[model samples]
Target: MKNKEPWYATTADGVPLVAAVPLVDAQEEEEEIPVLVVPPVTTSEVVAFAAAAETTDHPQPSAPTLEESFQQQLSLKEVPTSTTRREQKREFKREWRTMKRQAKQEWRQMKRDAKLEARALKREFRSEKRALGRNLSDVKQDLKQEKQMMKDDAKQIKWDAKSKIQEKKRELHHMKRCMRKNMLAGTFCCH
Candidate 1:
């Protein structure tokens, strides 16, 4: 037998043990879900990312603790900032125009095309797995749930952010209602 170990036995970070500190800590602490930025593409980069994230997870106790530092004596209104009103208005106009341009149907069409390309790649991989005599159904189901939760989370985030950025009281109130409902829904099923 060779001295080299099998690939399946190695960790993403090349460790023999599969360290699952983040998941374990999340279970123990009930922390609000942290933003999972896309991991870098390379295997080594992903390994490094996971390892670093695991280390960071230990230091985080809960979201309330993190929010406490920013919560005390906070003004509800955000002033136009260091920039004067006129300068802020000009910047907001520029940003709004850019945002409107990006919201156009042509941009949406391009995004749709990109999504179709990604779906095609996923289909190809599924077929390749079938040819390899591997059952990918269980893995696919887990991926489906994760994707749905991510989509809902992203939509909620976008709407919440829009309400904040526009400073719309009615929209903010409505968004809060929706968020409360979502929290209740998750409370029943989310682990």
Candidate 2:
């Protein structure tokens, strides 16, 4: 049987560990070369590597405290107490009902006032119309009386003018008869 070569290393805990491989081909059989294996990584070495990778100019963030974390969780939940929530709702409802009642009362009062005002205006307008009608009728009656008086006066003046004209005509005829009689008695006078 050929001698078997160890291809891997083991730790104390039986964990299989590997480091950087030596710069030699394992499958080649032309020449044998000494392999230089690196040691397995330890926890302190890992921590030193991490610290070396980060620069000191920048600050690292600190972990939150227990109390701060608890407060943050509580804030995220933001649950209100049931009793306080109920009281707030009750107050809101009471205010809403009060406002609604006040608005309704104001509306009713406004309607009543408007109706009263309209009725009063209607009565005033009716009274004015009736007064205007009475004044117009009185003026018409006065105008009719004046017109009748003018007609009667005109008729009386016409009758008086006709009687005067008839009296003048009768006097003229009497004078003419007297002249003729004087001429027949031989006492003729030129008129």
Candidate 3:
């Protein structure tokens, strides 16, 4: 028998090739030869075969684990407003900051208004105090003038009364002197 070249059959879908070994002409071609040894397969071929076998046997769908179910529930409940949850949170924060800033500005404005009102009231009080002070000083000055006039009138009346008393005393003295003289000359000059 002549030795033949090693035959390589093209494999389908990355499957390993299987070559038929030629035997000596003892039995007809229709007879089957029992295979005693398996063909040597590469490591890559074994891995490919394992992967193909694993793919052929479809695994049954198992129930979700606790972590996976929790993750899925979180994902489902995360966004209900069509927007993302992070975006919604950012919007909420921005609105809150705006409200806070507005409130602070309003508070500051209120304080400024209060300060202005207080200053106005203080100015009004000061003006009133000044006016009252002027009025009090005027009244005091008027009272002083009135008191001086009254003192001058009292002094004038006292001086007039003293002069009148002196005149009356002088008149009395003169009349007494005259009567004495007439009595002394009354006997000799009876006419």
Strongest candidate by lDDT: 2
Kindly report which residue stretches of model 3 are placed more than 4 angstroms away from their true locations once superposed: 1-83, 187-191
lDDT score of residue 9 within candidate 2: 79
lDDT of 3 by residue, 13-107 (tens): 75546655555342544454443334767899899999999889777899999999999999989856738888889989999999999999999
Report how far residue 128 has shifted in candidate 1, in Å.
17
lDDT of 1: 0.68
Reference-based TM-score, model 3: 0.53
What Cα-based lDDT does every candidate model obtain? 0.68, 0.81, 0.79
What is candidate 2's local distance difference test score? 0.81
Clashing pairs in 2: none
Give me the displacement of residue 190 in model 3, in angstroms.
17
Residue-wise C-alpha lDDT for candidate 1, range 67-151, written one tens digit per residue: 6656643544444364688887998999999889878967899999999999999999989978755446767888999999999
Residue-wise lDDT of candidate 2 within 1-191, one digit each (tens)? 23235456778997768754546665664455456677788899899988987855677689999999999999989976547877989988999999999999999999999999999999999999999999999999989999999898888888888788788878787778778878788776454
